[model samples]
Target: MQEFELINRYFKGRGISRRDVNLGIGDDCALVTVPQNSQLAVTTDTMVCGVHFFEDMSPRALGHRAIAVNLSDLAAMGAEPAWVSVALTLPHADVQWLEEFTAGMHEIAEYFNVQIIGGDTTQGPLTVTVCAKGTVPEGKAITRSGAKTGDWIYVTGPLGDAGLAVEARKQHLDIDPEWLKKLTHKLEYPTPRVAAGQVLRGYASAAIDISDGLLADLEHILEMSQVGATIQADKIPTTEAFRQSIEGEAKWPYILAYGDDYELLYTVPENHKAMLDNKLNQYGIDAVCIGQIRGGEGKIDVFDGEHKLDISAMGFEHFAEDEAC
Candidate 1:
């Protein structure tokens, strides 16, 4: 299919229509308005065919993930998502694949009330890049550099399910079929914590989404904030499926180092703990506290009860000499 025809058929005039978007797809430059008293939050993410996902991944899931990951970044900044521009590259367009892909993208966009703006489509190896935009009240956007000593660290939900899913697929390990199905679903359709993030704007001292594993992403916050942390290893939440499928020492890498959970990891000051808890509870968000920030230079220590555990691996990094996954 031709480029314009492909976009017109599958992407144009679809998804939520937002009043803030003055002009959308089909225009040379899409126009959008930032709300008064708010700052625009923007993020971009790209996923390549073999590097980011398996060749056999579902087109629908790919579409969902492409937009979801970018929105996750906005969520980390306590921003309300407003719009997205998708740049899709393909070796060739297949009608069925485009239908499924657009369906998935539109479904999530509509859920977040975000409009699809203009982007380019080109011929190449299969890839998708999404640039998401959002808004947060001026001076209210949470950042990684805001962490302080004596702040409490928290996560939106369980970790390592997605990592386990990837490991299971790569190693061909024996796992219960039902459990594997649930793990795979976590890997593909990750929920960006949009509402919880908005609630955390004033309450969280520092914030980040767990796209690059808990330790790796938390290190970003520590480095930016010029602090350190000590996490209770046992307190790091994990699914019953992960606990059952993986045993003993094998669990640490997936739980601490592997990525793609997409849950938010944030820190809150002691004085704001009660208010933060009440706000999250009102939103039906069951956030778990796992650690505390300390006065040090960006070091993270893990402890399983009284015993200090030695951890060498941090998280996923592209172009490293030894890339895990």
Candidate 2:
């Protein structure tokens, strides 16, 4: 089927008036109206087979994640997702795979109220690219540049677990039934903190999603905000679920460098420290103050009390086919 006509079929099924869509489907671009007094937040992300995922990965989860990752970007900016355009590339159009993919995509879109508005399709190696749009109150979208010198840094959930899960899958590590099943799913299907992002709107000084690893990604926030911080490795949440997945010696690699954990990392000024519990209460999520931002020249200090772990400051660089261990 022709890509434009397929898109036309999608719009036809929706049954909504075209007035809501000033332009859609076929054209140089698609246009939509954002009502006055709203801020528009748009994010685009791409995932490649083998690099971002593996051949054994579920078609459904891939579709869900293809959009979920983009939505997480919107959440980092404190935006409520409203629309998404999926630009999918496929080696061949397998109807069954497409159906499962769309099902997965719509599941999260409906759950988060994001509409499948418009995008492009192409023929290539399998890659899912999504550009999601969201809305926030005018001037209220959280940015990575707002942290103050005295603010405290925070992360939404356990770190390193997803990274550990990935390594487990790569190495085909065998472990207790209960533990192996849990970690495998974490790697295959990540949960992004959409609710926590909504609640964090008013409280956070600066925020970003940890798509990259902690050290690399967090350094971005500190750089933009002109601040520094001491991140306690001990304070970073770790669980038996994570611990059981790894042997003790290789734990540091998973904790420090593996990427694809979709949790949110934010900074809060000292005044809002007391409101941490209240801030996260509505979302039923725990917000941990992992570190504090300071006035030092832009450098992130990671420590385990007194010992500092020597690690690179960046996460997985997309074009680096040769990975440094």
Candidate 3:
């Protein structure tokens, strides 16, 4: 059967929704409407084999990632997930692959309470693209540029675990069994700080999801918000497990430049810091104040209290063919 036909069969078999979806599968484009008093938040992310994941990567992981990255973007906007659409490209329609992939995607959708409302399937290179839709409370979408000088910078979780996980897999290090599983999970599956973003709606002056490394991503907020920042190299939260794995070695190289972390980096004003801290513990996530935004233009400083650290090696630029080769 054709890939779309198979998908059509799957969608028909499930029978999830009918109202609010005026145009679904078989149309040139799918259309849906949101009720009054809600604003739509949409984000799309694409992953290709070899580019995003290594060869022979598990379908379930790909499926989970396909949605997670997009959802992370929505979380940065403080959006509550409502519906998601997928665009999958595959060389062939393998039933086992589709089953596993959808299962993984469905797991996250259920967890976030978003339904797979519409999408398309086609034959091509093995790529997964997800466009997720979420809704924020009217008049309250978090942005990347609301930060002010003296506002406290915060990160919701540890950094660089995903990068380390990728390195571990590439090297096939004989890691301790316990640590191996955790790091592998980190690389393959990063939890989006959905709950944290939701709670930060009122307290956060600016917010961004850390798909990219912390410094690099925060630099986005700085650039957009027209400000500079000073980060204390010691203040970033590193998991005891992650720190132990590195044995007190230098961390900024990876933690500041690595992508795929999928945590939240945000700014909360000093006045709201204690309140936010109280809420952080109440919400059950570690919120680390890493730095303060300052008034200036496009400058980021890394320091150990009094001494400055050169940060020439920061941010992930896309690899060119020459670099890849």
Candidate 4:
């Protein structure tokens, strides 16, 4: 199919219509207007075929993930999603695959009320890049540098399920069929916490999405805030499904080191803790308290009961051998 024809066939006008989008797909450039008293929150994420996901994975899920990951970035910064642009590279124009992919993208885009403004398509091995834009009231966007020494650390939703799916697939571990189904659901259809991010606004001191495992992603906040932290190992909510699915210490590596959880890890000052507790439940999000920020210089300590656990920094790294959490 022709390049423009392919886009028109599968992607054009797929996202929800938005007033902020002065111009959308098929244009030389997308023209958008940021609302008064709001700042644009923009983020881009690229997913390669083999590196980011198995080459044989479904295009439908790929479409969702391509958009979801970037949305996760906006969520971390307390932004409400508004517009998205997609740059998709393909080996060839497989009509069926493209249809399913766009369907997946449309599902999330409509759910979030975001518009697909513009993008490009090209021939390549296979890669999907999405640039997501959102809005946050001026001076209200949560950032990594805003964390303070007295802030309490929290995470939205469970962790390690997506990571478990990766390990089960890569190592050929015999995970229970029912459990594998659950784990893979997390891996493939992660729900970006866009609403939670918006609600966090003035409540959170700092926030980050857990795309690269808890420790690795939390490090971004630590580095930026110039503070240390102490995590209670038992307090890391690994979900009841995870406990019922995996056995013994086997789940620890996935919970701590494996990436792709896409949950939000954030900090709230002690004074605002009550406000967060009161408001977060209204969003139907459970924020688990796992740690506290401290005055040290980026040191992270994890404790299991009375003993301090020894853990290495083993989160996902591009172009490096995989390591355990």
Residue-level error in angstroms, candidate 4, position 31: 1.4
Best by lDDT: 1
For 203-256, candidate 4 gives per-residue lDDT tens digits of 999999998888888889999999999998778887666887787666666777
Q: Candidate 1 vs. truth: CA RMSD?
A: 2.4
- Clashes (backbone N, CA, C under 3 Å), per candidate, total 0, 0, 0, 0
Error of 3 at 313 (Å): 1.9
lDDT of model number 3: 0.79
Report lDDT per candidate.
0.88, 0.75, 0.79, 0.85
* Tens-place lDDT digits, model 3, residues 201-248: 899999998877777788899999999898987788776656656643
Candidate 3 TM-score versus the reference: 0.90
* Model 3 segments more than 4 A misplaced: 1-4, 10-31, 172-174, 305-307, 315-325
RMSD of each: 2.4, 3.5, 2.9, 2.9
Query: Model 1 over residues 161-210: C-alpha lDDT tens digits?
Result: 99888778877889998999899999999999999999998899999999
Higher-lDDT candidate among 2 and 3? Answer: 3
Task: Give the per-residue lDDT of model 2 (tens digit) for 1-325.
Answer: 4753463354333423334457765577777888689888988998888778776678888878888898889889988877788888787777777777777777777777666777777787788889888888888889999999888888888778777666656656776768867766666567777788877788888899988877777788888988887887767876588887665536665665665778899988778877866768656887777888877857877777678866654344432333321
TM values, all candidates: 0.96, 0.88, 0.90, 0.95
Rank ordering of all candidates by TM-score, starting from the highest: 1, 4, 3, 2
Winner on lDDT between 2 and 4 is: 4
